[model samples]
Target: MTIPQAQREAAELLARLSGAAPVETHISAVYVGRDTAWKMKKAVALGFLDFTSLAERERFCRRELELNQPHAPGLYRDVVPLTRGPDGRLREGGDGPAVEWVLRMAPVPAGDFLDEIAAREGLPPRLLDAVADAVAAMHAAAPRAETDPPAAMAAILDGNVPSALRAGLDPGRVRAWAAAARAELARVAPALAARGAAGFVRRCHGDLHLGNFCLWEGRPTPFDALEFDEALARIDVGYDLAFLLMDLDLRLGRAAANRVLNRYVARGGDAGLLVGLPLWLSLRAMIRAHVEGTRGRDWSVLLTAAEAHLAPAATRLVAVGGLQGTGKSTLARALAPALGRCPGALVLRSDEIRKRRFGVAPEARLPAAAYAEGVSAAVHAEMFAMAATALAAGQAVVLDAVFLDPGHRAQAEAVARAAGVRFDGIWLEAPLEILRARLAARHGDASDANEAVLLRAAAVDPGAMAWHRVAADDGAAAAARSAIGMKGHSMC
Candidate 1:
């Protein structure tokens, strides 16, 4: 049968089964029923993929089930064969000769899709955090892949420029972006190689944008991962994450993007990933620009964003220090989103680092022994090292800790100085009674401090405080931003 004939038959069958028109994409059609949905790949041979043969379709149908089931088990049900009997009537599953294959999945509410949610009601901070957690968990469990990071990235750049030009984007802008991207790739090649050697390269969701996620079991679950191309999906985790970050920045706002970036890194993502973020973000935006342009949509904004990603931005270090419950973390989070680059600075919190040192979650409480002088010293050292690494990568750093020791505070300044970036320190101060009350009410926090711990910290005479002392109140973040010479409202 001709390809068009097969396509028509599949659509008719799905429509009959679903009792409604099917949703169509360039490559596939999905029929949504009351509780279930069936997806069938079209019998068309695109340059990147060809699903014209029944055998090929069956193989990819099973491949889709394998790739997505582990990530969203509740949504990806199974791959079933559409077979024909002796009478030549098509049925979903049987022992007859198979004509086509379909992937069955649990139907999700349209409003529950992340993109739909973003359009109807902006993504809340809590939901955004959950999205970060979900992506981080998937990355942590992904098996590492062997590939040349620099070469893989170079290939993407090579493919994108011509595609953008062909899709009717301005040739001048596309060419300019190509030159800047190549230069950036050359600059970060060594770092990318090192990240690959350190096993940061892995099999990741190639299309990790907001539209590829849905609310499943009351949590944001990623689905419809790019399953047809292994080379495209097997990539650096940082590159995989860039798609989501770029999407959030373009759709929601930079503040939302900043929250996800910080949360992902805090959940054990390598801070070194920031080294190539500019290039990765630009590449993702360029892809969207061309895809939209090809469809005759408004893609000028995306093209402009692609150029902006390569524009240089100044990096700096900002440290927020205070006793427990002085709201050092709160102020740090509030100030981080506007600090440096598009997604803002990386907030390195001592409490979170200490928890990581103990091989526990951020909110997991540690024993008293875990906070001994030696352990505390190690935590501070790691925090400073991470700050230096991020600074060297041209990403701003935010140190969140109680600088009870003057030496630690000095080291924070020294890291910035070594990186040749400006440094600013803000000391938060709050009433003793308020500190005790706040510490008492805290739960599920990274800091294990309590009333007793707060008292001990308060007793220490933090020796002639020299940093900008700001009152810990509702305006603390604004005051800190102003003190740091930043002229903008807080984004967090």
Candidate 2:
């Protein structure tokens, strides 16, 4: 790709200021200095975007700052000009006619970029949780958009094919994938429209992937939002999240992807969004396939991933029930990544539901009245309802709760039966001493139960337990997996 003369001059000017070479992409060049980085939009006319004019670049530079500043804070500073002084020398932020524009940002350490971190140490569970929290936070604050989601999706599908073919992908495969994707979109069109009306459509981070995230201020922060096109940036939050999910599935593994998905939902992402996840993931995979093809890289794996996203998967509901401190939530989370679809099961915990019911964070403590019999019943009911909703969407679900009341256990099974899916119940058990110690050590947990609650729960006979009884120990996950007949299955 030839560097246009104007962009070349701008890059050179930025390089001089930064004392480093510019990192070039198709549409922009970034020069990282000791304390700052300057990003200059290339003077080019790609079919999807046109930044050829100086005025247009300046406008987009400002737009980029405006879109990303709130999410990244001090990282996105301001848009400055590359000016031509009377001496005919190009200068950065000079008082002369502006020749080009650049977005200035705080310099991010190369190793802090999520993609580099993934490549080096791999994403740890804590970091993956943080990543999900960051995305959920962004979605919560995103401005709602009124665009027709179905039409927006259709337009994206239509735009992908020609570019994919032009990038030398197999024409037949591209067309077939497009056809299947369109069919899936048609099937879910009503759900998409309903979600749009409910305000799930928003101006989102248009290009959410590992490469665009970095550790800033010791937290995973998203940056470099797609700025050139408002149409691309405005989308369903689920679709925005899908890019990162797809990237994680491909780069890290399905387990990592599953962790992020469950964590995101736990942080208040709508479970209803699961209905369109397969289609969204397929589209994201296809985007990567063509982008890689264009860069003269092997895109076959990504193409295969695109096809796999639309493949049907078995769905079931698994219930993990036990008294407080038996580690039901732990086992449920461990088992969820292996169940059902790519990113795995949604774990609906009664504790988290109860917290949400009272408009509190998961770790917030509630008054005794909040856990009264009536409140507990309502929490169980909400958990079952959420499970049913997810199962109906062809997603697997794991219910995490203490089903001390036989009635609640029966209701859980009934929900699965109604959804026409298989159900497995695992009852975790532990000695009173062990349970007491576990409860006593709990901190910042959703469960408010302590030794007193544990002793009380222990005194109540969970009548005629018919579920698989597994010892609540380090091997609990393995025992639960075996009891569920998942011995040979590959975990996500």
lDDT of each: 0.89, 0.90
At residue 317, candidate 2 shows an lDDT of: 92
Estimated TM-score per prediction?
Answer: 0.97, 0.96
Q: Enumerate clash totals for all models, in the order shown.
A: 0, 0
Give the per-residue lDDT digits (tens) of candidate 2, residues 1-492.
456885677777788889998788888888899999998888899888999888998899998899899999999999988788878988877888787888999999899999999999899988998899899989999999989999999999899899899989999999999999999999999999999999999999999999999999999999999988889989999999999999999999888998899878877838999999999999999999999999999999999989888888889999999989999988988898888887889989888888888977677899989999999988888888888889988999999999998998899999999999999999999988888888888897889898878888888988988899999999999898899988644642
- Error in Å for residue 409 of model 1: 0.6
Off by over 4 Å in 1: 1-4, 490-492
Deviation from native of the Cα of residue 44 in model 2, angstroms: 0.9
TM-score of 2: 0.96
Show pairs that collide, candidate 1: none
